[model samples]
Target: MSQKDSNILDLLKGNLVKGDKDFELTDEECIGFYFSAMWCPPCRGFTPKLVSFYNKVKCQGEKFEIIFMSGDFDEETFHEYYAEMPWAALKFDLSSIKDTISEKFNIIGIPNLVIVDKAGNLITTNGRGAVLKQFGETVSLTWT
Candidate 1:
């Protein structure tokens, strides 16, 4: 495998939670790394919007997936926040991995969505903007 694929595998090695079940990454054309927290008011507001967007694209059978990277202070908060999301999340116990990902992406704030291609190449760091400004099909076209 390439270095980028190796890095992605290391980062996403652990269990990913989606609702009550564990989720595995597959042949998604795009992956979104979503950084946010329950304590952040902006995150609280944006989460619902993102959920809607996710559902819309998913219903359309788009090969897209989002992996939440919680910034919550506790596991309980992380669970609470994650319950409202429809996508998978890095386990709360994997804070070190999350930190590494945050640093790699230069994440400076909550509610940030960084999009990457299947090979782990960056598609856009301004994914939140793309979601907000474009429809699901438009966003997919831009990313892919």
Candidate 2:
């Protein structure tokens, strides 16, 4: 199991995805989540940057993903707005993590990005840097 998966397992008590109760995260993928809002100007600006960064990471064969946490509107609206982001998003059971995601991740605003290790522990708040610095020997090793 990847280190990130192990960390998230503790929080996987209920379905993280909607309509898929049997779904379980694998141990290999590093998860990224973006806390955003439809009306939040910062979120709108950062979404493109975040999406650009995410695509680069994926293209480099990095085992990482994102779960966009919508701070406004319902799941449908969230999906409609971010229909092209190259990562998975939270579906049902949003209330389960609304406060927890805010407090646990110390997220007081939108466009916040949190990077977790394979075990789901905090790796970097600078996920954009991780992808940018992937050419370095140490960083490449850490993610690979």
Candidate 3:
């Protein structure tokens, strides 16, 4: 496997998760990340919309979920402020690989969405559209 592929092998293998540190993606659970912050206006603007979408999917019994990565803040504030989020979020404590995500994904600003499947493969290059499309698709499939 290439270096990148090898690095992501675990995420691909369903190792990354929320709530339960031991819980993995199990052929279900659509994992996504909102690369934003509580400080940025656009990030704030998009948050509620994202939350609404999440609530809808959750209500419909979809197996997908999202997380928040505070691209530019400490973990304490991240958790304290966004405690009401419908989805799981990365712990605010770890900041080591923060840039790794930005560099690899080329995230330039706030409100960027990064989504990976159960196997850690990205769903689309277009983050915004992929988030909407995938979450919507999951909801639709689950409800009907």
Q: How high is the CA lDDT of each candidate model? A: 0.83, 0.61, 0.59
Compute the lDDT for candidate 3.
0.59
What TM-score fits each model?
0.89, 0.70, 0.70
- Candidate ranking under lDDT, highest first, comes to 1, 2, 3
Q: Model 3, residue 80: displacement in angstroms? A: 2.7
Model 3 off-target regions past 4 Å? Answer: 1-29, 129-144
User: Please, what are the lDDT tens digits per residue for candidate 3 over residues 48-132?
Assistant: 7677777776787777767666765666667655665666655555444445555667777778877666666676435555445
lDDT of 1: 0.83
How many clashing residue pairs appear in each of the predictions shown? 0, 8, 2
For model 1, which pairs clash?
none
- Candidate 1 regions off by >4 Å? 1-6, 135-144
Q: Return the lDDT, model 3, position 125.
A: 39
Candidate 1 or 3, higher lDDT? 1
- Put down candidate 2 lDDT per residue, 41-100, tens digits, no spaces: 877867776677666656778777677677766666665666756666565445555556
